[model samples]
Structure formats: C-alpha cells, structure tokens
Target: MPGPDYCDVDVLRRIRRRSLAALRADVEPVPPEVFAGFLPGWHEVGRLRGVDGVAAAVETLAGTPVAASALESLVLPARVVDYRPEYLDELTTSGEVVWIGAGASATGLEGWVALVPADAVADLAPDRRVEITELSQPARWILEIFAARPAGVGRFARELAPEVAARAGATAPPLPPPTPAEFAEAIWELAWAGFLSNDSLAPLRARLGGSAHPATLAAPATRATRATRAPRARSGLRSMRARRRIDAPSTTAPHLSGRWSLVPGAGEATARILGRSLALVDRDGVVLRGSVPEGLPGGFGSVYRVLARAEESGQVRRGYFVEGLGAAQFALPEAVERLRAAAAPAPGPPSGLVLAATDPAQAYGAALAWPEACGPGGHRPGRKIGACVALVAGRLVFYLERGGRSLLTFTTEPGVLAIAADALAEAIRAGRLGRITLTTIDGAAALTGAAATAALRGAGFVPHPRGLRLRGAMSRPESVSPAAETTAASGPGAGSGPGSGLESAGGCVDA
Candidate 1:
C-alpha cells in the first residue's frame, strides 16, 4: 500500500535530519535518485520468447540463424513498449517481404524493424523482408549504450563510435571529447535533477573553482567555509563595520553575524543572539526552506512584521533571501552565550518571545519576567507567546501550566503527559520542588495507565485521583472574593484552594 504523501516541508526536514545523522555515523548514502529511478519515463524491461519466431526472423532479416542467447543478449538492455501481434507471421515465408525500413532524425536509421512472423508473409508487400532489425543489434546496442552512461551527446559519441564504424561501409563519426566545463555542467544538471545533493556538490565545485560560471553555484558552500571560520570573520567583520549594520548581505548573513550579546560572568563566553531584524529575515527564509516548527506563534504575520522592522532599520536592502530560524531553543547558558557573541550588536536583546498567547494578558505578565527570571537566557524584548493547544481529530487538547513553572504539562490524552510526569519527578528528586500533583477532570483509567504507572514505579512518585466535583464546585461558587481567597483551585478558579490551580480529591494541590 502507498503511504500518505508527506508535505514538502516535512520531507525536507526528515531528509535533513536523516542526512545529518548519517554524516555523524560516518555513513554516506547513495544519492536518492539512483534507486528511485531518475530517468523519466523509463521502466524495467523483461524478456519473453515465442520459439517458432527467432529462426524465421533471422532467416528473413539478418539472413542467418538466430540463437536464443543472441536475441536475449540484444534485447535485454533495450526497452520495448509492446510486441506486434503478427511478429511471427512474416519471418519464415519464402521470398517473404517481411520488413519495412525507414529513418528518423531522433533515432537515426538506425531505424526500428518489426519482426514479421512467417505465417503472415502472404499478407506482406512483395518487396519486404522480416523487419526484425528493430530487435537486431544496432537498435538494441544504441539503447544499451545510452542507458549505461548518461552524458548527453558526448557520452553517445564515445560509446557508440566502434559500433557505428563496424556497420556496413560506414565510417565512425569522430567522437567529441568532453571539456571539463561540459563535465561540470553535467554535474550541475544532475544536482538540479535531485540526483546529487548540495553536500555531494562540494568536491565538484572545488574542482571547477573559478572557472564555473555564476559564482553562486557554490555560494552556499562558500558561505559554509566562511561560517566555520566565523569567529575570525566575526572579529574582522566587526572591526571593519564596528557598530554599523551589515544589511542582509545574502542568505548567509544570519549564520555569520546577526545579533550579539556579551556572556555574563564568563568574560570569554560569546553568544549569537538573533535580534528582531535578523530573526524576522531568518524566519521568512526558514518558511521558504520549509522548516517552520509546529505550534510556534506567528504565521506570515510574523514574517511581514519582521520585514517591516528590517525596512525600518534599513537592514534588509536586498530583494529577497532565505536562511534558517537560527537555534531558537537553547539548553545551555554557555550555548546561548556563544550565540550572543556571534550575533551582530543589537540595541537590546529581542524582547518579544515566540509563544502562543493562550492566556495573552497573563502570559504577557509572565513574559516580562520570563527566561530572565525563570529560564536560562535573559528576557528577550519582543513578546511573541504561543499557547500549547492542539486540535487533534476534532478534540480540543489544552497544554496547561501553573504560575511560575517552565514545565509545560497538560493533556486530553493520558499518553501525551508522560514526558511531563518524568520531568516533574526529576525536579522533585533534585529538590527543585516539593510535590508534583496532577489533578485532571478525568476518569480512573488515566491514573492507572502507563503515564501514572511509569511515574509511580520509575520516578517513585504517588498518583492521586481527583474528582470532577472540584471542577463544578469551583466554576460557580456561591460566594468568592478576590482578596479573601488564600489558595488557587487545582483545575480552574481565580485563586482559592491549592494556590497553583490544581485540584484532586485530597484537596487542591499546587499544579
């Protein structure tokens, strides 16, 4: 059965991920097209024989005996779409007018001959011979030569010369020697056809060097070299421009120098911070390249906003360009610092974070102090918040979090919360927090399922089942006050019980 057709973006991402892994593993896969069949309209040909036919065909056309081996060898490599029904009819007739010959420019004369079966010879024109020439040496040989080697006219010239010379009274045409330029062009053609990836083009480009037309053929490769030497480039380019903006130079500008921030405490620590201007451009580039992460805030609006900022800053002077959305999520502070050091100087770190505005007003308040106060990197200026809510199969699943927690946990499905449970358990063990209480308006099955099972056994945490009454009781309490309440409800209430918005049968627990 055929699989679902994946989107172009997903396919590119999977390919990139797979290729990167293979590189790390020290394995190089053959180009995708080799096994996938890059030759357009080409199909595998299989052999079939009707024994009575060959002897008569050879007698009529080649005027010699036809052996099965010779026929098999000749036709195996050549492609045939269909076999003529009367193929055996004209082959064996006495004075059989078995074949007709014609020449065409595309195939050469070097023309195709039909196998005329002997029994049908009386129906043939008197002057004809069985046209098994189509099945004979020349046609099959030419097809085989072209299929084996795929250089254009040059390949045909070299491979077909001896055969052409061997044909009756024919002098072989002089073979046109391929120039290095021609070879390079062929490489590029193959690359464009997806038979060669950009990674594989490196050595080819190095070989062509300055001779290759349009320096941009290797532009991506050149930028890679420059980026690997980026620290030096960053220093030199910084010394050259100093505080000046390096208006989007090309697709590579983001990788080299876009935004920068000094490492805190580690005097030598450098970070490549992506400023609003660069991030915007890089985001657009990422979309074009199809690497947009799912559930991240900002659609094309984010892109347009970035473009507007670039225009305002006079940063993006070029017509159009593409690049990736440089490492957005960072694990280590040092890595963030490294990124900052590599970045172009910005007025300040980009303030707006990229988050879904699930609870925009509250999330905004959280954003002002986020990352800086709660997470690794300091607070970035631009606040783009994305809420974690996905509509899977028409079910509205909300990813929830309480006040002052970087750990995102929410679930409509029990399996989805497994990662969060493990994380919560680890946090508790490390003394990062006290107790991780999950209060869901769910049935007993959720607590007994794999998520709870793993948490109880693997993480040594206890699972507490909560009742649905808390949800109803909290929703419309007869009397409640803003300041009078001390604890927050576990599920959803202003603030009254557990203080963290989590509620179970034992009472509200800090979510």
Candidate 2:
C-alpha cells in the first residue's frame, strides 16, 4: 500500500479533520506545528478547531461574512496560510475555498496563498512543486531586534526600526541594513506577534511610505553621545512626563484626586526575610520597639542597617528598615502604644528577676535569684552566652542560652508568654530546630516554672521524661491564657524581681 498521503493539500485536510475531531471528542486541538512538514515555509495565520471556530477566525481575517456551510466543509481544519502575494489571484480563482485576501493590512505582503481545492492541481505538471515563502530577511531582523531590546521597545513605543537596528549593531550578527518598506513589514510582523503595540502601526506605515530608506525615518542624530545621552535624556524626559502626569490634577475625573503617592521600589530578598519576622508580630497587631541585637540569620542585620540609614536620610526605599541599632526597634504606631502599655513600670518597685546574659549585671541578677547555679561567692558561672530576644504579641521575650543549652526565658508580661510559645512553635515547624528541651536544673526551673510549662504544653510542647521537649508536630492552640506570675524569691543578685522563666529549650529561640 502507498504510504500515508503527505501532500500539502492532504496533510492540511487531515490536520483540519483531526483538529475538528479533537473538538468533537473533547481532546486537545492539533497545533499548527503539526503541518510544518507539509508546508515547510508557510507560516500559520490562524488555527480554528471546530466549524464555528473556523468560521469565526475566517470572518475575522476576511473582515466579511463566511458561509457556515463553506466553513463546515473545511470541517474545523481551518489552517490559514501566509504565502507570497503573487499566487493570490490564481489561488482565489482555482479554489472552492475561503480566501481571506493577502495579509496586506498586517504584513504588507509580497504575496499570498490559500487552501485550494485538491482537484485544482490536476492541470498542473506532476513534477511541479509549490514553494512556500519563508519569513523575509527583514522580518527575521525585526524579531531579533525585539528579542534584543524587549524592554527598550516596550519603553519607547514608536520609532522602533532604527533604535532596534542601532542596538542590534552593537551585539547582533551583522546584516545589510533593511529598507524602510522592509522595516515596516518586520514591524508589522512584530505587532502581529504581540511584541509591538497596534497603535504604533499607523505612524510607522506613514513614515515608511514616505521614506526610501529606514534612515530617513526621524531618529536621534547618530553621534558618539547619542547612544549614551539619548537614552538617559529620554529616560529623564519620561520620568518628568510621568511626574507631571501624576501632579496634573485629574481634570478628566473630578472625583479622583490628582495627588500622586510615592510607592517604594521592589524590595530585596533580605527585606522579604525581615518582613516574614515582622509579619509574625504584625499578625498579632503587636508593636515591637526595643534595641534587638543584629543577629538575625540570612544577613538581615546588614539589610536592616542599610534600610534604617536610608530611612533616616529620607531615602524612600523599600522594606521595613527604621532608625535604631540593627534597626531592630521598629514598630507600628498601634504596636508602639501596646508595647508602651506592656512595658509600663508597675506601681511597685522593679521585680528583681532578670534573664541571665553574657552581661555581668544580668548574669549577677540571675545568679542572685538562683543561688544554686552560682558559685559559693555568689558569682555566676563564666559560660558563653547566646540570646534571642523577640517581640511577640506586644511583649518582649528574652531567651538566654549557655553552652548550647537554653538557660532561661524572661518576659515583660505574663499574658504574652503564650505568644512567645507560639513563636517558638512556629520556629520548630520551620525546621530551624529539632525539639525544644527544658531542664529543671540550673536557671531553667527558676526562670520558667510549672505555670509557664503548662503554657508551653498548650502551645504543642510535651514534657520529656528527662526535660521539656516540644512535640514535633503538635497542633497549635488557638489562644493561650496568661499563667499566674511565676518568679523566684528575691535573693543574692536579685536587685529586683522581674518576670523570669525556665521556658522550653531548643525550638526557634536563637534568631
């Protein structure tokens, strides 16, 4: 048997039939590339899946009514073609087919082709071959130009050819300069590809019709500085125009305000990371205002410092950078008030309790409260200390770690301990920590007591037989009630008793 018919007409007809069958079958429609082998140089004008789809596409292309039956005969294989214009008359007269006319309005065509009746070829020589035209050199040039400076082309909507040519000359493979007509054709192709704006076509067409060469079209005078200065000047002009447009009162719409607000540029990755941390606080509508250390992971410290300085110098940059060391003490206005209320000194003297840190004063305070952990001389052990202080739900929670182990957690208010626990839970969920371990010995018991441990349990923590370890995948409680004030009795270094705890170890304390 003869191999499957690969003739152009047979292939196109099969493509249409299969494509229509796909529509009826509710399967994927055949793509235009399926016909690539049959029509080697022919570019796809449009593809219509079903009879209705075909009719609509043809009518749109022809800009006239297409008989439903004529479209139905094509049967959803409405494979439109772009051929050289020379065959338009022959193809139209010889076919029982839809001829949408050459794509003159769009491509400024050299020729055109159509779906001719298979029988029309009977009179032709058997050996004669139909040559499909490739995209003209100018069209390819235009594509390369668009590919090279997509941003610039988008920015400067008109006068594209020379700018494209000039830019391409700097980097692209050298080719003979295209004529104005060729440039127009290429631009029209680009517009068809949705690269150039449709509105640009009219003026470009007019200019091309008047000019012999693309050079005649008005462009910046070629100079050593033109390449550099022109873009900068254009950018400045564009910026000024944008500003003026913004400043100009909205006369067209009186109800709308003409005032333009400055929106910050795109934020850096560091800003996004910092935002995540801030979001944790912001979600609770809590303000965080204090001097936090610059030790956040992912170089957030440097990002914060840069942003904070920029904010101070009146540079309206993106991200949550405010003035302060590590830019850590920033808060929303509501959070600020909340923090102030939370940190407000009680009527009585300071609660001598203090969270131990590397600082001698704080360590001494901690040692005073818990004499068992301190030496006989009432001096705290000299151990490397790591601390993570976070503001959660309008309260500051401090976690102090000694020798890779969490020592104690101190909170400003009892009500916020749950929020602190939740923060730690979130950290655990993020895989920053394996489990939270809390020991009854050392400063752990003195800082966080039975009441605080209950809060951690409510926040998805399990009291390990050996120590307190948060459950890896515990469901977080919606809300946790404040535990009763748990503080160690005033002792040696206890200058005052502040809220202190032996909260759970591990989890996400060291930021």
Candidate 3:
C-alpha cells in the first residue's frame, strides 16, 4: 500500500475526526540516529545514573558541556508521571527539590528527604522522528520548548528547521520521517508555550518532511488557546468589546498539568496556583486596570515571578509557559477536545427561510423574519405549538389555518425579528403579500388566536359584512333573548366551544 497523503488541512481534519472518534495517534520524536550527522558537536550518553545523578545533571546541564552519556542519565522512567504538584508554595518557596527525569516515575527520589514529585522531562518530547547521535545547548533548548508547549512542536520544528539547517551547513541530513503524531505533539507543546499563532510555511509542504500543511496548524492552536483562555479573558475584555458574547466556560475542560479555563463571569479571574495573580493584557498591549489571576503547576512557579515583572511594566504577555516541560507530562487530549469544542465558532442562521409570524400574532400583519435551524426533521424541538417551555432552536413554531384555509407558518422566538424584517421586505418586492406588520404575543399558545388573521391575509380571504350580519340574525331567529344565546353557546360537544374540533389531537375539556 502507498503512504498517507500529505496536506495541512487533511492532517488537521483527520486528527480532529480521529480524536473525536477516540482513535487519536501519539506523536513521537524522530530517533537521534536519523539526524546525527546534522547536529554538530553532538554527544552520546554512556551509562544510566540513579535519580540523584539525573537531578544533578539537570541543574548543571545548562551551563556545562554535555557529554554523549549524559542523555542516558536524563532519561525519565514512567512512574513520575503520576505525581502532580498540589500545593504551589511547597515546590517554590520551600526550596523543596523536585526530581526531573527521563523516565516516567519519581522512584529515584524515594526515601530522599526534601524530595518532591516533578514533571517528567520525557513528557516534553516532540512528535517528529529525527536522528540525533549527539547533544547540544540548542537540542536542550528544543526539549525545553516542547516541555512548555506540547501542541506547537510541529510548527515550532518547522520554524527551527532553517536555523538548525543553517547550523548544520554541509552536515544537514535528508528530510526525516516527521509523522502526523509528531506534528501534533509539536503543536501541543507550542500551544503550551504561548506561541499561539501558526507559522506554517504553506506551499512548501515538502519542507516540513511530513504530509502536514500550514493551514491545518491555524485553527487547532487558535481554538485551543481561545478555549483555554476564554473564561479568564471574557470577563477582563467584556468592558472593551461593543457586543456582549455569551460565554460558556469549561467545567470538564480538562485541567491537565496545565491550567484549564473555567466558566466565564463566575467570579473567578485568571487563577494562579501560587498566591500571586496575573494581570490582564489585551491584544492592544494595554493592561487592564486590575491585576489578573494567573496559575501555574508547582514546578513552574518561578514563571509567575517573571510574568509579574512583565505585568508591572504593562508589557506582560498573557499565557502560560512551562520551562523545559515536554508534551507527555499532562496528556489530556479529552480535556483539549472539550476546550476546542467550547471555543468552536457558533454557526450562522440557515439561508433562504423567512419568518412569517410570531407570538402576539394579532397586532401585526404577516411580518417576515429569518428562519432558525428548526422545523420538522431539522434537529430542533418545539417545532409544534405548545410543545415545551424551554426554547429549543430559539422558539416554537405552529401551523395555522384561518377559516379552515392553510396560512403561513411563523416563529415565536425573537431571533425571527431580523429574519422577519428582511423576508417581509423581500415579499413586498415579489408582491407575495401586502404590507407586513409584525406583532408580539406573550405565549406560544396565544398565537393560535392570530392564526385566523394571518390565514385571512395569506389566503386573501374577502370578508362579507352582510354575510356576517345574516349569520348573526339566524342565530337569533325567533327574537331569542341574550340569556338563551348564552346558554346555547355554553352547551357544546366539539362545536365552536373550548374542546371543539380537537378530539383527534388530544383535545382539552373544561368540566
């Protein structure tokens, strides 16, 4: 069989669909061997040291020249992934030492006093496949970048490719097998790191090595950032925007190791795990008057300090950054999906349907309004009159007939107002109906009264004043007294009375 087709949109759509179906694939970094030749001054790890050595290596690796064998010492076991930092103060102010390792487990720190659970470095690995026989500061920086933003790794990798390629000179390797999973992992990391924008070099898809394109990178990152930030941002920005948007914050929007958003306007600001709060900075670089609350997992408490300084100067960026954290640390794809959906764009009204009537139908003639995404078999409830109290698909609709002649249908929800306005104007142009007069009624059941009027207008029923007078005279044929007429009106089966003509459709009777 041939290999998978390449395209950014296709990759994004496929991942989105697969993720929705619970069949998501994992992104793994390319092997070190594939790109070994490209990385100059690379070193290999020798033997595995215990947890203490690994921690020491982490503390000093940034400043010291790394040997090849140091990578082995940094490898994380799987067990450490289970421990999460609960109290913010313990890890930062307490001077408590946290273990950062290649394996997933925190066992190396067991029985060691002052030892606290730490984020696994392996959790930050990018999803792409590349060979590396040696190590360098840049590689370490790349690892840290992944740790901070697991979602953006793929895009970031593409960004770093030119730099890395430039550094490689004649030693640059061929394009490695950078699969979709790796691209996704890269994206996750980038998102975590506050690189919220997509920098996909489109029309140059072949350069990214995998089948992914640049456009695919745009929405997920934007959606993830919006979903993650909306709750906090909505309240802060409400006073600025002209229109007020209804915000639905995440309740089950996963709170993986990274901060997840909560519902908007629920009395929560940018929540910080530490006691300190983050100041809100708008897109225009203006900081809100009040300080915004910002939260961080225990290991990243130091980041808040940096952010606070930035906030004071009104230059603070509003996003989270985990220094050197990897993608696997808090793999909550489910939470990510929830946030994405919550932040997904709301669809516009369906095209081509006009609103003919609304509740309080008596006051207004046939007014047109925009039709909602409702009706029979339109996945909307309250399509029938008196269906339910709750507004489903905006409002209730009822079919009507005046004098037993079918008339136009109407929507009761106020969303139909704009629709009605536009549609009625069109009808007047087409000469379908006369001047449209819209009305409002208190309830869906009340619209039954206006049905007759709307039916007359729709069917162009010509009223005969003389004919009505004759019927009235017939009712009082022998000079019947008003008291007798009242008695005759009250005595009824299903004819011109409360329960009349509705027995086939669950008629009501007043005992």
Candidate 4:
C-alpha cells in the first residue's frame, strides 16, 4: 500500500492551529515532525517532505484520542545551534513567522544571526541549549564579529566600524551594518534564546533617543509636585504673608534665635496669660510678637481655656505673655529638648523603635508620648490621649481614638512608614473591619508636614476636608452584622483597663 499521504493541506492547517494555540497559552508547541516519528509506517514515507508531510501525518492521528494525547504530552528537547541567516530567510520566504516572545529593540538581527558555535553551546547548561543546530558561514562571521567585542554588537559595529572592516580580511567586502529592521529581527531571535543583553541596545537607543514619538517621551507632573505648587496660585497673599512671618527679622526674640528657656515661675497663671494672647512662638521659645491680625478668630480667653486644659493635662510646661511685644510665649521642655537633639550632630545610623504592647495602659502611654517624641515641633503638649496603638511591621506605627480616629503617628526611616501602613492594611483586611479614620488638626501642621502627608497618601490615606482617612480593604458586607459593626464602631482602642490615662498630670504630655 502507498504510504499514507502526509502532505494534506487540511492536516497542515490543523497542526498550525494547535501549535498557535499552544504558543498562545505559553505551552511549548511541539513541532509536527515529533509526532510523525510515532505514526505507523512513518519511516516508510520517502523523506521528511518539507513541513507539509509532517503536518499531514500529525493531522491523520488527530482523530485518535490516544495518539493525540501522546503528541500533546510530547516535549521536544530545546537545542542551541549556530545561528544561520539562511534558515531565517528560508522560513520567511516560506511565509513562516517565528514569535520571539521577548523585547528586541536594540542589537536587532545582528545578535540573532551571530553564530553560537558548538563549543559555546556545549559550555552552556544542558537544558539551556534549546535547539539542535547546523552551522553556516554567515553565522560564523557574525559570531566572530561579536567575539571581537563582548560589550555589545551594536556598540562594536558603530564605534569600532574600522576594526570590524579589518576583521573581514582584505578580500572580503567591508561588512555593512545591518539596517534597523534587520537588527530588530536579530535582536528578537537572540532574545528568544536568552542571549540578548539590554546593554547591547544602548547604541541603538542613543541613536534613536531624539527620534522617539513625542507622546511616548511626555511625562505627566507627579501628584506631590503638583500639590506643592497648587496653594501658591490660589492664595498668593497668604503664602507671601506666611513666608514673611517665618523670615522676618526679630529683636530680643529668644525663641527665634533658639536661645529661650522656660521661665522659673511660669506655670498655670502664666499659661492663662499666654493662652489669652494666642501667641505664635518658635520652637525655641521666641514668640512672634505683634498685633493680632484682623479677622483672626479665637480670642485670648478661648485660647486661655484650651491652654489651661492642656496645662492641667501636663501638656504645657510653662508659658509667659510679654507686654513689651504684645506676644505670648509657651515652653514645652520635652518638645524643645527633642528639637535640640534633632539639630545636634550624631554619629552612626539613628536608632529606631518598634514596639507591640499588649497592655493597653502601656500602649496608651506610648501613644501619648509619640507626639512629643516624633511630632514636628514636638507634640502640641496636650490633646486627647490616644486609645489604641496600631502595630505595623511589628512596630507601634500609630495611635487611634475609640472612634477609629488617628490621633498620632510615629515617624520612622524613609520607607518604613509605607511598609507599616501596608502591614496595618493587611491586619484590617484580616480583621474584616470596613475602614478606619484618622483625625488631626491643621494646627498640627508643625508635626504632620507635607512629607508625612505624602507618605500617608501612599499608604492609602485620602485627605478629606476634616482630616486624613483610610478605608478598609475588605469588601463591604451586604447586610451589616450587629456585632461586627459594633466592634468596628468602637474604634481601635475603645475598651481600656484601669490606669489607662496619664500617670501624673505634671511633666510634658503629648498627643
């Protein structure tokens, strides 16, 4: 009987379809030739009659589930062979396309066509040598060129064109550099074989840098940069006034010069007097003395009340109202000392703190101290104490009130906060809490500056008119469960044991 016809067009189409599908799914598509060897009387066929015969044989067995499964399971060994330009040309002439499955922007066709000698392939890991190869003269020439310059083929070709010409020998015509398209193709092929180097593309990139599409080169302004520039345009007067206030020369302003000290007798009486004045003082204790600006709210009495409360809570250490400049000055010893330490030069990497306290009292104490320890100008002295502390990356990251309000957050190294935020986020997700909110005063601008705000933003905090808030990552429940809702509503550190408040209403208090 005549050997089974192996050149049927229908069989070729089916094989091609299956191969494409396999490739699309990232599964290695076995060449039809592998299956041809298993077919009955396959050896009887006169020769491997081009690609058609292999396809036909594979198609004939397609209907047989056992045969098809065998073919599907077959994994051909990947062999590395010398690169041959002729093979590529032949494949192209036959309307065959090779998918590179990698970026090929640089050395182009030259890298692909570069010869990988048998010895070179042998030197590689066995599994790395993906295709069996037949050597060709062109492949050898390209390999020699590449060997001459190990840095990259494109750079060698461009920067050392004369050397390449000398390598070609007197009788051989000067080797013309590959065109862009040819180079791209070579790069693609080389990349598929894992031989392409990004450095090799440097020369091409340098040459084409100016030629990139305008749209591709364009970059939008970053949010942080935009945020910094936004307020200037909308409130030029306010910006200028603020700048003047900070930069204005002062006489006998001890706080401005960072030379101020707490007055010996300054206490609750002094706090009452200074609070009434609503004075703005530098961290050093120099009060910005001047007439109260028009339209400024919160008279001295209201200010006094707040200061008295803070003093009673041990947040304010000392205060004074200077009649000479019509200004009030307050001293927070802890805050001032902290500022001084920050300015003092220190050797070695700064120390870091990471705490996870199970005792609510301890956690609360730390939370109260955080504002002074890490706040910008030192903590504002007094504010509502935090109820619970959130541990992020095993560190006490921030404290929250009973209502899920963020009272204070401790600063860490440059990138630590982001990590901690992510950890907290994971905890919230695991706990299935819908969300958490952090409340801060704009007056706390001294502590929570732009950088801290930006970091918080990265950690999924969004600024609302009220304050910065972060929502839970867990999906909202369809029907709110009463127990779960109550737990979430109670906030992070709602139920505290005894002695959760300040140990003594005396020294500096923060947060």
Give each model a TM-score: 0.20, 0.22, 0.17, 0.21
Query: What lDDT, from 0 to 1, does candidate 3 have?
Result: 0.24
Query: Quick one: RMSD of model 3?
Result: 31.7
- Residue 98 in candidate 2, Cα distance off native in Å: 61
Candidate 1 lDDT over residue span 439-473, tens digit each: 33122222333443343334344332321111111
Question: TM-score: which candidate is best?
Answer: 2
RMSD for each of the candidates:
34.1, 33.7, 31.7, 38.0
List ranges where model 1 is wrong by over 4 Å: 1-275, 281-400, 403-420, 431-434, 441-457, 464-511
**What tens digits encode model 2's per-residue C-alpha lDDT throughout 184-283?**
4555453322233321112222322211111111222222211212323345333434333222222112111111111112245555444434432332
Per-residue lDDT for 191-210 in model 3, tens only?
A: 22222212221111111211
Segments of candidate 4 deviating more than 4 angstroms: 1-371, 376-386, 391-395, 432-434, 441-448, 473-511
Q: Report lDDT (Cα) of residue 311, candidate 4.
A: 45
Q: How many pairs of residues collide in model 1?
A: 62
| Model 3 segments more than 4 A misplaced | 1-159, 162-185, 192-376, 380-511
Query: What are the per-residue Cα lDDT tens digits for candidate 4 across 1-511?
Result: 7887767888886876665444324322222211111111221122334334333322222111111001111100001012222332233223231111112223221111111111122111111122314322333334455565533223322222223223333334634433333333333343334333222222222222222110111112222211122223345443333333222222112111111111111125444344333222211122222222112244444444554454444455333322222224333445334333433445763322211121111212311223343554322322121123444322345544333333456565546666655544543443222244443422242114455556666766554333444554433533435564354334323323222222322111111
Deviation in Å, model 2, residue 290 alpha carbon: 11
Q: What's the TM for model 2?
A: 0.22
lDDT of each: 0.26, 0.31, 0.24, 0.30
Q: Write down the TM-score for model 3.
A: 0.17
